[model samples]
Target: MSLKSFGAKIFAKNIRKKIDKWASKPEATQKKVFQELIDKAKDTKFGKDHDFKNIKSYADFSKKVPVRDYEELRFYVDKMVAGEEDVLWPGKPLYYAKTSGTTSGAKYIPLTKDSMPSHINAARNAILCYIAETGNAKFVDGKMIFLQGSPEMEEKNGVKLGRLSGIVAHYVPSYLQKNRMPSWETNCIDDWETKVDAIVEETRNENMSVISGIPSWVQMYFEKLQQKTGKKVGELFPNFDLFIYGGVNYEPYRSKFENLIGRKVDSIELYPASEGFFAFQDKQTEKGMLLQLDSGMFYEFIKADEFFDENPKRLTVGEVEMGVNYVMLVSSNAGLWAYNIGDTVQFTSTNPYRVMVSGRIKHFISAFGEHVIAKEVEEAMQEATAATKARISEFTVAPQITPKNEELPYHEWFIEFEKEPEDLAKFSKTLDESLQKQNSYYFDLIEGKILQPLKISRVPENGFQQYMKSIGKLGGQNKLPRLANDRKIAEVLEKIIKA
Candidate 1:
């Protein structure tokens, strides 16, 4: 073995030992970690304001600080942006991760010195955990490319504003930085297409072993690399064996990715967000990602079905159960107090606390009283694709409210295909059938004639890309919403396809 690979294997073994000890007793470790996080942040501005001094327990914390969304915390965030200190956390934050907001144009989430380690350390540990579990440390020996957002951060007052991935890029460990691909200059290019081309030119000849990014963008990068080399990804980078991805579900793109790579590679999924790095795939045998309980964040869950209730039950890690969808609430050292980040997740295993992201709370379809979430839609699409042997590039669904005195409301699917199925009608039928089988409410709507059967509109190649570009959400961590309550995204897709 090469010296580099030998060193990586030794390093990975050490990390594995640490992880095994840390996660020895999951439940007890989580409770202790949560308490420690609370104690550390209790002296901060938010903690003091919320009477954190007297908050002795999880019950006290929950009762004191009510759950709040981004809009509710905007006042303090505005203060932070205006160069205020200790407004939320102690002193000032290192940077602010700008992200899309549900009720607002944008949200600037704080990234303080206290909270930065969670983002950086958790990401590092994720890879280390995977390496340990699979005994595959050679991935760290060769070049590893991360297709991140622009590293050109804009300064606001004294704070920096940029994508979370870009912010993390600046803090990559010195040792690993040697093997990291894409020059800082290339990553700083604001235009995604231009930056991608630059990245391909720079890294196509490197001894690349690991690639990390959102699957869609990474797919684009792989396609571009293939185009340049006229060879499959495996051939281009013979050592390529690890793919780390997040930002969206990987189910839809699994087949397409396998085909592009020419073989299956060990993969790890992460649940990193602008707010925090929550979880990561640790064990190859485990189905769900292992929650980062020791990360400097306290987590709470509100049952998604009862989230709109006058008073919903809030559960701590100790109280969460398996197989229930819950909207996440976080109290972190970043100064966020009982903040709702708007992502919904379901716990597949409660012993070690492994979770799968169910969907976004705001991104769902419930028109005609048929509540359909991202998980169901994605699974339905997976079934449809498998049954029809179709290859989907990208897709989004929106409710089509029937006109007044018109026939019936229905769901419209805007699908971009890499390879079209032999029969479009059969594909549409299989999709509808799969959804109906999964959601009883949807099945009832169609059976009762309250809604028409779902309709499929074949989007033109790169239709989603053009639409996202038009709306200034083309690249980086921005993801296409899988389901919309209205026709806003649907109309945009239609317009883009027509154009």
Candidate 2:
């Protein structure tokens, strides 16, 4: 390495040392420090008329503005594209993080200079907390890998919006940024599948010490890595010590990961989105992740039981009760106020503020007009698998609308099993019973003659993962979208759904 690169490493080490000191404090202390940081945000305003001074506390601040969504930001983004100043926040939006929504295509999320720090700091906290947990502050010294979209998201106008991963790299303290495989400048907007393959090839020979990305894509990339490198990932990237992931459920994916790497990865869960990074793994044993409430944002949780047109309820951070699900609404420095991110989560405990992300509200299957959620499916599948002695690696459920000739609509599951069962039909029946038992709505729909039996397709061991790879759409921020609820998704499912 060059002298500059070597010097950068030393600088990174010192920075990490400082972060370690900050994170070594008790969780309660960190929360207080973060709250103070948030208080400063309230005091910082753009114009003389900016009304934040009237807001005395987090509860008062949240009540002043109704919860918002991605659509609200899109309106501001439109203004930014039209050359409007201070459109997204109080200042110019310095970066637009392009991310896909459930529908209406890609949303160009505006990130002002003020808001980016929240994301950067939250990520810093994640790293430092991990170090504190493991007692290893020099974690970044090893080679790192991130399975991300191609750094080439050049738009039709020739202006390049850096890939989400590239933007992170650019903002990282220069000393800590890893020596990435493909130069970010060369292929910023390359398709997701292309990025996955390129990342696999780029890291084929290198010894990666840390790996990070969405679980679905990471699973795909590892599968491809094994195929192309002709060696298991444990052999190729022998030094890999940590695997950080978020943006998807790890339960459907955990086993496949263990088999590929030949060991249990030191997994860390993170909540990162185009808007901001929200939370991270809190404790080694619990299912909860801690939120960065004090990092440039104010947070609220909507109670799952509360309703406005039957929608979930919103609760302020202070009002949160342990073990109840709530939707997240955020007010960020990026100019978004009371934005509902559409994710559902529950606090496992509140003393240290531990939470578990349940799933997306709109991303569930209820084809027979019976509301069935992803978590319900996961639970039923787990119970059925345990009872029938079948192991499922990964699975997705699609609602198959009836053809013009068909009489009814039904649910189809694309499942990859650990081992082919001797009696697939019996296994299917057991799973159906499990689903009925756990999800009464699903059971009612199935038994009362609203829907038919759930169809099962035994997918080729890695078929879905490969399909995502073949299409150049796997890894990092991109994932295997569950609950293909629309017609476009239906058509895609038609081709993939087995008889």
Candidate 3:
């Protein structure tokens, strides 16, 4: 075997052993250690540098820092782009991870070296958690494929360096780093299309075992692989063991993947962002488990009701209650003080600190002005799927303005189904009813005629993925955004919205 392959095998073994240790610990012990890290972080440069002087205790820390939203960060991004740095941070930002948001335009988030380690460690633990949960560590013996953004970085210092992907390459355990795609650093700046195309061609014949990245890209690549090989991907990559993903919800996309592969693929959830890697999927379940990187930052939470108010209270890691929805705030190595990324979370357990991502603060539709939150939408979606006996592949929801100028607006749904339902129209109506029952304001809006009838677009095939690729957004950080709040967004929706 080549040295790279040999090294990967060794690295995989070492990671598995390390994961066993992390997963074997009792929940209480893990929480104790995590809390100690949080205490130390409060005193670290990254922590003290934040508005923590006012935070005498974890409770105080939570109370002092107001839960902020992405718009607040965008205000800072605009300033940095304009050469203002006072509120942005102290050091030079390494590069911005372009995130697709509600509006078509992307948000360029600053990611510095300080912010990098959080994601690196979080990704590492997410894998470890998977191993401990499944008790299968030998699956990573072959080449692993990561379908992420290209490795090319813009030219700097008379030399082009791949930015984030390059950083990932450099930071991956030295042993396993050799197995990464796109060897040459100079090819980093090529747009995702050219890069993905090249990656598809290069890995066509390689024996890949582990695949990682967003579900959409993986789905697209597997489709291409089928077209080229004229056989199931398992025939080509028999050793492929794990399919890890994060950055978006995995529901609706899971069944399609299982059917294509002819077997269920174990998936690991990762919680990473331009700012930090906050959590990972636990070993016990495919569902996301919060990996508390206590050493890197001090955490705070504000109840959902308390998120936007000026005088809202915040909760610390110690003070958080189980199953209550709270917006997250972080003071990390990158110097973001009391920064809220608009993520809502719920505690799965208090001892080990496992949490689940609830939803985005801004990603919701309130056509009836009932102010439907993302969690509510998710719950309604789950209920609708269960009741209608419809297996949705992928979906997005947005509020529409009817000519009636009604109080509650119409909700438009874009969906792809796994199979044709026996009662397609009835299924759609049931979905609408489920949404209203889940949220009475949704029903009130319908009764008042503020919102028009719910429209559904069961796409022909591969419709959503095509839409994503057209915008140069294929993997992680690209979810069909809810509540197209911007005026221009209405124009884009007009083209995609169909009954």
Candidate 4:
């Protein structure tokens, strides 16, 4: 083994011990984190506003501070952006993660020095844990590339601001910097298409062992590499083995990726957001990512069905149940207290608190009150593809409340198929049946004839790409929404619809 590989094993051993200690006593670890955050931020503007000094327990904190989304918390965030001292956290934020917001224009999530380690360590430890468990560390010596946002940043109120991925680019550890691929100039290319082409040229002849990025963008890179050199990804980089990804579930894209690589590769899933780095896949054999108990974040979950109730019960980690969809609220070291990040998740394992991102709370189809979430639609697509032996490049779901033909209103699936199914009708039926099985409201609507079985609209090849590019989002750190409540995405899709 190379020296770095050998050192990684030793480092992983130490990190695993810490992981085990916290995982074994998750509730206790969380309680400690909660206490420490309350104590440290007691004198900050937000702490004073919420009476943090007198807060003794979760109940006390909950009573003092109601759940707030980015919009509600922007009042305090604006003060911080104005260069006020200690407006939220103990001191000024180290940086701001500027993310897109629909109703609120743009959101600036604070990243304090205290919270920075959570993002960095979680990413590092995920790799280390893989090394420790699998005893395969050769990838450490070979090139690894994370297709990410540009590292270029701008200044906002004395604080550096950029996309979360871009901000994180500045923090890559010195040890692995030597093995990281795509030259600095290539990464700084603002146009994603140009960047990917540059990256293809830069890394096409190098030794690539690990590739990480959002799956869709990575797929584009893989296709470009194949075009540049007529070889499978695995053949191009025989040592390539590990694939790390976050932002979206990788299952739907797995078949296509495996085909492009010409083999299967071990993958590590991560659940991270601008608000926090919440979880990472610890075991290769496991179904979900393990929550970071000691990440200085206190988690609260409200049942998705009851989330909008006047006073929904906010359950701590100890009270969350396995397999139930919950809207996650977080109080973190970053000064976001009882903050709703808008993602819904389901706990797959309660022992060590493993979770899967089910969907976004607002990214659902409820135009007819069926309320189909992203998870449901994605799974439905999975089932349909499996049954029909169909391959898809991309897809999205939106409710068609008004039909031009005056037919029954129905869900419209805008899909770009990589390989067309022999029997498209059977594929559509399978998609509807799978969705009906998962959501009773949807099943009832179908049975009662309030909604027709979903209609499939073929999107021309590269149509989704064209749509994204048209919206000026054909680049790093952007994700396509799985489902939308209205026809906003569907109408635009119609212009490019093939059949």
Please write out the lDDT profile of model 4 over residues 1-499, one tens digit for every residue.
8998999999998998889889999999999999999999999999999999999998899899999999999999999999998878988999999998989998999999999999999999999889989999999999999999888899987999998988898999998788887878888899889999999999989999999999889989998999899999999999999999999988888878888899999999988789999999998988899999899899999999999899999999999999899999999999999999999999999988999999999999999888899889999989888888888888999888878878999999999888887789999999999999999999999999999999998999888888899888996979899999978888888887733
Compute the lDDT of residue 50 as modeled in candidate 1: 86
Candidate that scores best on TM-score: 4
TM-score of 2: 0.80
Q: 1-499, model 2: which lDDT tens digit per residue?
A: 5554345455445655654453354344434643553444444332122355565555555455556677755665676656666444554567777776656477776667777787777666666666555555444666676666555445423224655666766665665555544446433535666766767767777767788878776777887898897777888887787888888777666656777887886878888888778788845676778776555665767765452355445566557888665777776766666777888788876755767787676677755656666666776676666556665667778877774577667777878787655578877887788778867788888888888778886677666756566555544565665665655544454466552
TM-score of each: 0.96, 0.80, 0.78, 0.98
* Evaluation by TM-score, superior candidate among 1 and 2: 1
Q: After superposition, how far is residue 299 of candidate 1 from its true place, in Å?
A: 0.7
- Note the Cα lDDT for every prediction shown: 0.86, 0.66, 0.62, 0.92
- Candidate 3, residue 453: how far the Cα is off, in Å: 6.2
**Which scores better on TM-score, 1 or 4?**
4
Task: Give the local distance difference test score of model 3.
Answer: 0.62
Model 1 off-target regions past 4 Å? 403-405
Model 1 lDDT per residue over 1-499, tens place? 6676677667778876776675667767667766776777677667778887897877887788889998998888888899888788888889999887766877899998988998998888888777666767777778999989887788998899898998999899998889998898888888888988999999989999999999988988988988899999988889999999998999999888888889999889999988889999988888889887777777899999999999899988878889888999987878888899999999988767889999999889997778799999999889888887888889999988864577688899999998888788888998899899988999999999888888888899888889889888777777888998999998888787777
lDDT sort, best first: 4, 1, 2, 3
